[model samples]
Target: MTGTDERPDAFARTDDGVSVAYQCRGDEAGRPLVLLAGQANNHHWWDGVREDFHGTARTITLDYRGTGASDAPRDGYSTPRFADDVVGVLDALGIERADVYGTSMGGRVAQWVAARHPERVRRLVLGCTSPGGPLAVERDASVRRALAQPDPDAVRQTLTELMYSPGWIAEHPVPYGTLGDPGMPPHARRGHLVASNRHDAWNALPSVVAPTLILHGDQDRLTPPENVPLLAARIPDARAHLLPGARHAYFEEHREAAGALVREFLG
Candidate 1:
């Protein structure tokens, strides 16, 4: 199947028989960099910022079970399972290990990837994500209410506000694809929501052996900035950085600086 970018999609069948779709781009000789997207989002979540890594790494992106070209089973939607899907992709591609970067819910999955399969991750970058659970700081009540708004327009507006600053959004009046997979089924969406909500990687976080970098936006209202220290404290030797004046989509809002930081760290 061809993806939105017209690249042919590759398939990897999970142990449970679900087919996950992935796409690879950039320098073939470059090191592999696996990018995990946020809640309900497909590979396109990185559309705005993925090219920044192309010069130095082969960027790999995939759709979760319910999104994009992947098969959506009624069951198996937890972060750990999502991590397993990532491993399936790597195994199918004959990649033994690679650098990993995840954002939002994808970061939650990356936590499991590094923790459960430490041998498969060379370095880790967690962007605009929380550790998830009581130890992690959550969004404010107002933000939560806005996110839960029933109207699609309201949700998009809320997401836009949460993702980028007013100035940035005004300057770049284009879609960031934050709405996730347009064709996602209701069950898959619900599963993603439940899985992300129930994510509790506190006990497993210490097991993550990969060198980790935790990045967040100082002005973020979605995940909040306070969670960065909490994540850094749990993951041994983890470094934390905050992007000034950025929100949830800090990686996209400040791509140059964020990309430089990632490139340097991975190198």
Candidate 2:
């Protein structure tokens, strides 16, 4: 089961009357770590590695406005909007500051938060993401086709293929039957896609005062690994970690290594 399945659901009301869904785990000690998932994912994306942080930090996983149990409005899906939702979650939970980790499009959201609200973020971790603009690398045709798939099952299957390395997928296969639950709606997914495509953080990276870490899979097809160096170069105090032979789901496939790297970086 995923983390969301094991943890109780909670809601944080955004200023604009939207309810952002989240799940909090781990102990009350150390800085809180907020996890933001990819374009089409929810809190469950952290299921494989979240428990590794149980004793190290308070881990909070949130769903984007248009995904999961979060309130999906007709519009308003931007990186800044998502960043505000992050602040809303923290405010509702009475958390003053947090170390934020985001993947894919969520990484773009994290960039906005770190840039716009420097004091709210203690540190930032971005994985399998890019500094969107003309400078960023493009996704392969197959990957683009997969992301644009409308059917839930088709999307999940295509996503699985794009995420993991063939070797990893073969050794530890996913149970496709239990993949997507309460899948994202077509309109919401489209909103997320548009927001991601329009995100441009190249100019804002230098303003992100938080110590940043960029993690990418060397074999990542959706978000090219080439963007890693560009992100690290732009962020004032940033470093990059590229996992060899790994794909988009490197964090889940190499949970132990990724968890250790994150813990060390946060400390």
Candidate 3:
């Protein structure tokens, strides 16, 4: 299935009154796969790789409360809460269970989902993420400073450079825009940042019963490649894979290989 069969964008109201926006595509009869985006990113974050699962999985993507078309509430921003929002979306769509693939902040949220709601996840794929808390390896201060540039354009440029290799960026230049939802308000963006920073799933990871695959780019500086093993060690049934010469956006930069790996694991 493709464009013709894609479901229209819809809203799933969370218990807290935030209406999360989601869309479904790919094979309607195929196994369901939920693609969770990074912090602050909306459903569009999966646009580049979603098609890779077209024939084998019914792909579902959604905008978290503070991003995309979802309502941006002033509070209730945390990784665990984000996980609950995902469950709410599934409940609204009448989906009982699904395979889940999450990258960056989404990966953190996925950890909580599998831990807190094991019955809702058949399999899990965590890409470019960490276990959070003090045990997790953090990026260098320089990388943090670069990303914290006051100018949005500078921050975007820094992110683009950090996410992809120079050759890839030159070959496919991205337009000037925020890496996440461009329309995200200051409060919402801040909420996302805080939520991402506060994520600590170390204690809960051992409770994840779903088989897991951890992917990371060896060259990643934003999330650091070191966190992959930390995650693999915590999850009961998990394996880790690293992509050489890839950065934070390895899933996009190496979509073919990444997609193939995810397909095989989910199958």
Candidate 4:
């Protein structure tokens, strides 16, 4: 999967009846680095960031059950179900184990995956995410309002405002545009966010045997650092790093450092 000119396209269907969308690049047979996207985002979340990871490993990215190019089963998508989707994707691609990275809502699913299926995950990298359930001052009011925000464009605007800082939105037009596209799976978004708000894996953190690297933006408004301490204290041997002046999309805003941390952790 290695080559700068080679870009992420799409993976075909697995036997379980879901047409998993994925892109492969970097080392052909190296340990797979699987990327899971945030809430309402598809496989395209790692669009530019793929190059950073592709250099050292074979990168595999999949749009979870209700996001991106994958099948959006309106009825079958919660946090745990999203973890199941990863299992399905790995099984479909014939991958038994992989290094995993996720952010925000994606990070939640990755936690569940790593905890529930430790054997399948070699290492874990979490960014701008939470362990789950009522972390800090979780204002369900705004989130709920955002959920029923009239229509797609409104939803896009609402999420963009909450997810990224004004500087990030201004400088990074690509993801800003990506977030505002409004082509996301609504059912998945509503379901996932609701689940994420109330879900907590604090007790389960002790069971995750895989090496873990947690990254969060110092200025993150989405998953505030206030709640991250619980994650660090609970997860054994898990290291947490704070990115200066970064928002929720810290990985992209500070791509070099984010990539470096990931490379180091994965190594």
- Which candidate has the highest lDDT of all? 1
Candidate 3: tens digits of C-alpha lDDT, residues 1-267: 683455678999988888999898887898889999998889888887788898788899898898888899999899999999999989988999999999999999999999999999999999999999999999999999998889988988899998888998889877522277888889998999999999999999999999999999999999999898899999999998999999999999898889899988887
* Superior candidate under lDDT, 1 versus 4: 1
TM-score computed on alpha carbons, candidate 3 = 0.97
Global lDDT of model 2: 0.84
Q: Kindly indicate the candidate among 1 and 4 with the higher TM-score.
A: 1
In order of TM-score, best first, we have 3, 1, 2, 4
Q: Relative to the true structure, how large is the alpha-carbon lDDT of every model?
A: 0.91, 0.84, 0.90, 0.74
Q: Give the TM-score of candidate 1.
A: 0.97
- lDDT of model 1 at residue 75? 93
Off by over 4 Å in 4: 1-17, 135-158, 174-181
Model 1, span 1-267: residue lDDT tens: 111245679999999999999999877778999999999999989888887887788889999999999999999999999999999999999999999999999999999999999999999999999889888898899998888888988998889888988888899997677667889999999999999999999999998899999998999998988999989989996999999998999888898999899999999
Worst 10 residues of 2 by lDDT: 173-182
CA error at residue 84 for candidate 2, angstroms: 0.9
Candidate 4, 90-171: lDDT as tens digits = 8867889999898887888888889899999999988888777644444356666775766967876766766667877787
- Model 4 clashes, total count: 5
Candidate 2 residue lDDT tens string, 118-188: 99999999999999999988897877887677896787777787788677778976653213335778788
Give the range where candidate 1 is weakest over 10 consecutive residues by summed lDDT: 1-10
Model 4 — TM-score against the truth?
Answer: 0.85
Local error of candidate 3 at residue 105 (angstroms)? 0.1
Q: List runs of model 1 lying over 4 Å from the truth.
A: 1-6
